[model samples]
Target chain A: MNNWFKILLLSGLSFFTLGKAQEKVTIGEKQNVFSKVLNENREIWIHLPKTYNDKEINPAKYPVIYLLDGEINFEYYTGLSDFIARTPYADIPECIVVGIKNTERTRDLTPTKSQKKSPVNPEVTLFADSGGGENFVKFLQEELKPFINKNYRTQDYSILVGHSFGGLFAINTFLMHPDYFNAYVANDPSLWWDNEVSITRTKEYLEKNKKFPAHKMLYVSQADNEEKQKNWNSDMTQAIEKFKGIVEKNGSLNYKHTFFPGEVHGTVSYPGNYEALKFIFKGFRTDIKQLAKNPGLLEEDYKQFSKKMGTEFFPSESYLNIVLKFMKSNDFKEPETYFMNLKNKLYPKVK
Target chain B: MNNWFKILLLSGLSFFTLGKAQEKVTIGEKQNVFSKVLNENREIWIHLPKTYNDKEINPAKYPVIYLLDGEINFEYYTGLSDFIARTPYADIPECIVVGIKNTERTRDLTPTKSQKKSPVNPEVTLFADSGGGENFVKFLQEELKPFINKNYRTQDYSILVGHSFGGLFAINTFLMHPDYFNAYVANDPSLWWDNEVSITRTKEYLEKNKKFPAHKMLYVSQADNEEKQKNWNSDMTQAIEKFKGIVEKNGSLNYKHTFFPGEVHGTVSYPGNYEALKFIFKGFRTDIKQLAKNPGLLEEDYKQFSKKMGTEFFPSESYLNIVLKFMKSNDFKEPETYFMNLKNKLYPKVK
Candidate 1:
């Protein structure tokens, strides 16, 4: 072969080698476009899982978890989600966690502006330009949703999780547009904002809106509060009680609230987010009673359930045992028999 | 002054300024020497907390969590521990985590060697050099422990956590020397090593050794074995059941076992470690039921108990709430009344 021909062949071989090398998951930066109600050039941080490219038979689609305060909480949430989703009891499906970067948190989160600076950081402006939450919601609904839907094989269900100001935004969004998300987690929301204006608003909204959708909401509070001495805890308690009381009066609204008494505002988000995720997507009935009745259903049947459920079901042996426990609880004659049945249905030749 | 003296003075000032600039938590390689047991030549990675240099009257001794696989898991664990500890639960005290580097995992982890190759990696030789677990434990007990104790203002309580082969080593150490650590978290231990030799050894140890100390042990496993079609699930379940049964029989042993059903052995460690830490150091509680009936005990009496308990007692508002839960469960009439009596005895101002 001529020199040029040889060079082309070599280059081709190099390209193939490089492609193979890049096959494994690369942990770094990726540019994402955001064109909601806001401006055009909004970039997002996307962390692709380890097995993003290698498998060829069937492409995997991840459940999307939209987190607010992308800049500050991205690494944390991503690391945590990556860690916990891979665990046993809280085996949430592997997800594409889209950390929505914050440009103006106050403007986007706050329903109404209160002329109050954060007590902790007096110099730092809290709400320079407030009451842009409606516009922000529009951005998420119109632009962001369409973009994500068009690009990724996203399931119908999505989770919105946030902290403090971001927490308020999540709650407000859930209240205003219930259909947008399947689950909502609010960590230590600024309930003290505008003398509980949002709480009052929540009460009014619940009263007017009779049809509450089937979903999950987790409210978390930290122990170290600046306003604790001045009844911040009682104020938050009263607000939550009032909200819960109203929901009770209406006799609807799927939600749970937890107080992280020993946790501070800054640190409560991680564990709260973790527990919230676990609570929301708590898997299908693995209880013994349900399984024992359907004795023929084998391991393969559950495996199929996992596959069908997609990213919502994090596959785990412990989870299977949990199902086994449920089965045994219902006086299932043989745990091994059920397992064998599952195995035969799922993979007859193997094992 | 002379011309040379003037130049030297200016140079000294410049050097001082340079020193100030470079003083902020210097990263990279450093040789740490603890005592005669540890060689000074060993490279150490030290991270001082944000408040390390703060000027405070009563500088607190931070709790330390020593981790295996320093090179890989250190940064992640350190960041996580710091973040969570700073949160509201204050479940475990804010700990300074120390990651111990490994030279050879197989050599360090294994207590005995068998001439066998890994089924997955038959081409590569396995278990060639093993039985270094004893020495590895000694290194921690003698060299590392003394050095850390001498250098840092560390609390008496310490945690030992490891994963994979390292996890096997951690369990081995815990089994051998329970007094060395307050808590032990082993994630995805290699139970299938040498045809379940470790499992056999554990069974033998439990049967023979009747006396078990008071410490926490958390073992975690994952779901990847099913994909490999190995008996990974059975192995995990058996180990868990056996361990739990042994602990239950002993009554003196405090242990918990969790299986991450779908999680791969490689990825289950992180979440398992976090959860294990939380589970282990839940809190310090004393049986106050006996004192409850004595109505004559003044509020000042409770203050004495608080004073005696010192750092172990709940100081933060949220922790107080948890204490209240404990109190209520023990049939205490009112948390305020109970706490008031305790506080007056232990802490006058707070009561």
Candidate 2:
């Protein structure tokens, strides 16, 4: 390490002559909606998918997912969603994500007030102003959903996502307001509040209702370590497990339960979120090879999906564009005429 | 859905007047370093860690990790690293990441040119210009490393990270230019390239050398389904498995291997990069409770790291600031006096 050489290394570095792509970075834009129900101004972070941005004209409208804990988990959820949408396997259709930020963590997310001790420590009591969940639900329905529906290009299909205390909020929303969203994803929710009052509510709901809505889905993940490894009893994991068994036994709702064996409560969210996304969109992948193999199968698949969704799923132009792309890249000859014929049939309505 | 209510949701759909902490999102800065070795300009994306921006004066110098495949994976790596560094359980020390963008990805990343067909399809041959990996390593050593080391507050302790062909590039650089980086992280490297040429080379090198340097660490991850579930034998996972077994058997070098089940090749990079970071920095998290238990332990831990890094890792001021923060947050009474005594001992050097 010669001093002069090190100094030379330190200075006069040359730059590129070629024009560089402009450095562009965006998480999402901040959106604030005044809530007449909660009587406060609320904030949300909204991220539209890349595919939506790709076509300036005739852009596709996407389903929306409302996420809780926006201030902390917004970046992670958006990043993961964007990645999943772009990837080939389990190709998630682009979805608009509205990440709702917290005004008060304990005040809003919890379904009930509790003077009970923290599950981990009996000495430390849970937050005092803890029963604002019903009001929060009112705010989302009356203020945010209507605003998003009026402003954005949306299919009116929706999902709700949350973690920890936020997860508790998600389950409460699902139980009380079932028609609000098509799916709910909860990760390691703190169900131990007020001696597992939320869990008890869940049990009562399951026992009363013979069947949940057929189209709606619920995904709940309990972290492996919190109860067993961290303590013996009375934790979030235990309450979640109890709720899971009851919900699973009811067998009426389209429910998924993921138990992450090696992951703890802290690290569980990342994998939990990823796994939950996969579970929610179980068949949401496009196999190019499989599509190329049988053109008729692709047509039938979308028809079946359309019937299930109660919306016409004639995605002719985009499907044609993809077919052309594959034809160029993979030298696929048969799919070109298949898409062209499909497009002709689909375009008559547009014409 | 009343017309007047819809108009209200739209009209009052304004942003928050409530003071937001400001949504801050940074991908990285665009950097172009002219490579005299390759006679071309190379572009890179560099993300400085949280600690770098924490202070205006006496900014902290971090160990840099140079990541290959910047254009695609840069955002993922930076996002994940930022998340891990901030989290409580796996509190990775602030690290500067330099993501190297590709001009000709196949040309630069592959060590040997392949005339053979794609592993999946024997009809279609692999890329023609693929033997430039040695020259690419030269460009990194002579040009990019010097530029990053010169411009940034870097400790000269470096890590090289890559995935797919980029992962192959990382392993080749490790085998050939071992002294260039302190650590290497490869995620499902395409070691199947040139009929497992890199794998053969890795095996040869291990056989020749009795022991690798103690300071260097290597982390390799392979997606579970690629070789076994997707196809058999002649896949990326097989080469990686072969290499992993050999490296782990030698047991002289610091090494880690992660097998991600049910994850395909395309998506493994996200969790793989995350798992690799956790493995590389095992027991790297800072626990306030652990620190409170023994006041002398933090000093000793940094001392050990410093010795291992061959540079003084007494992260003095930042470490102190965090300790003060924890003491305030957790109401630790003893660490206050502990910090005062430690400051008296360490601050004279700073003064």
Candidate 3:
């Protein structure tokens, strides 16, 4: 090839790269999973945490959060997870969020083949294609989990989060297959399904097991559905309260139930999810200021947190770097050295 | 071209288009604005609401939210706004979020030349490059706002949101240029800047005017900052409380102060921003069930809300569509016709 032609081609390629300079800010990627259990192709939205791609740190495994109602919640949920998982005062371990988009909302979420008269129109029925909740859970455990575990750098610990009918699915999955996920979150769940079948399941579980499982966490958020003002003792509100009463009485499961007074059924998930994460990872945040005086406290805190969680978690290189920067800037020389050693120990040099 | 060659070219073009199908879920776009006032280029992140590009609806105008700390807060804030503004249960109008990325943090956000000894290390001084707040606001007012208005379909209503130093800037901006935005949100603002200069400014304004602007709204959120346990009356806490007292005593501005019991400075903004939007658009939510019985109630509620806001806020076409769907499905023929007429009146068909 001519030297001038080669130079022109190289210049054109450089221009194309420059033109492709990212104009849109993206949060997650779309991955299609063919689910044999459901006999369908499902699209999953995957959002990796900030440190997942950081070259400065060694490759790390992250807890996976399986979120239901992907299209509605994925955008905010991903951003919120990253925001709360920021270093130095991290509230939770950085985790990958897998948002499962719904193809058959009623079919995949309802645990039983039950139909209800629509609130607006009694002639019209709701949840006609229900009873596939068990099937959906099977897909998650058998196909989706393996796909995520195979493809991503993931930790053993995982969380299942859902709202409304999705929330019902989370609780049912927890009751049926307790070992599948480490923690469960149900936000304004449709616990009133089939005359409160969830309450019956809870009672049965306690009767059979004598106590809820240890180390497994459940967080349920109940919304103050204003409809109760008009129809006193609405089934939706009553069912949740009954479940809360039963669970609290049992006192074996690590559980937290928050009732947001002003929040409606549609909006309770925002604050509920935040509180759920904090509850699930209760001891995750370590004081950066305290670290200046006592560097060893970092590991001690993590040790205590891990013991409570029944999972192993270590300080990320990114977090250690943040701690080191704080210590160095604040003139805590000994602490700075301690963190430097900690970072090296946790994330060894590649070469 | 030959018939075979034409078919082959068409097939290749279709293949290329299919290969370029969307893989990443995007929330916003990045736009760089040249600010002659500041003599620099500023990158702005812009997030449009869901219905912005819907072919089914006519082009509509939306309120814009000017968010500070663009890099840190833009992603979640946009998502939160969209979530809250979902049709049929919208707590606020759909909004366009414009997040201004920082160039020089301390230089642009602080109101005056200010310096403070670091809490961790007294040898280091903070805000050395301060006092450019006025200039930054000038750039926003003169350059950025014009660029946004010229480019996008915008409503007259706009909100200013900020956190920490950015929060300080929001409060200062509200006080100095009250008419610039309809609402202001300051999440855990650095009210203690320059030994509580914001407190002095608040007092001075109250004394001079005896009342704040009638329609403008301000929402301030104070974090619990667990450090308060160690130092009961820290300057950060004291300054914020003092400002709150002065403003509340004056009782002129549409103001709200929320003390988040467990939220720290770093994490308060997530919930704070959510509450701030709710506070600003308190009367925006209309009951779909109520509308089924009283079709005229929608317009009445909007009128009352508009009167309170001192701005005209018509029912959005998307919202009207949702209302129509509810009425149609519920067999409320009269209400369905009423909403269809309302939608047509508000947003006429282009043809």
- Two-way DockQ contest, 1 vs 3, winner: 3
Worst lDDT window (10 residues) for model 2 chain A?
A10-19
Top candidate by DockQ: 3
> What TM-score against the true fold does each predicted structure earn?
0.54, 0.87, 0.93
Residue-level lDDT of model 1, residues B68-124, one tens digit each, is 886556555655665655422344555767777666778777767755644333455
Q: Name the top TM-score candidate.
A: 3
lDDT of 1: 0.57
Give the clashing pairs for model 2. B163-B167
Error of 3 at A95 (Å): 1.1
DockQ of each: 0.03, 0.26, 0.31
- Winner on TM-score between 1 and 3 is 3
Model 2: CA > 4 A from native: A1-22, A116-126, A227-234, A302-320, A343-351, B1-24, B56-58, B118-124, B225-233, B301-322, B340-351
For candidate 1, report its TM-score. 0.54
| Model 3 chain A poorest 10 in a row by lDDT | A13-22
TM-score, structure 3 vs. true: 0.93
Which lDDT tens digits does candidate 3 get at residues B1-351?
443443354344531121123389999887655566787657789899999999899998999999998999988998899999998889999999999999998999999998877766889987789989999999888777877887789999999999998889999999889988899999989998887887788878778888899899999999987563445226678888888888888888899999998888889999999999999999999988889889899999999999998899999999999999888888999999999999888888987
Q: Candidate 1's residue-wise lDDT over A96-137, tens digit each?
A: 777677777788888777666544334445577888888888
Clashing pairs in 3: none
lDDT of 2 by residue, A1-351 (tens): 443433344234433222234354665776656666776656678787766666522556788989998866777677788777664443566678898989888888988877765443355565877899988888888778877777677886888998888889999899889888888998888887678888788777767887777778888887786533454323776788888888888888778888887666666777788887787665555556566667677677776765555455555355456665675566666776777677667654433
Chain B, model 3, TM-score against the native? Answer: 0.92
Ranking of all candidate structures by their DockQ, best first: 3, 2, 1
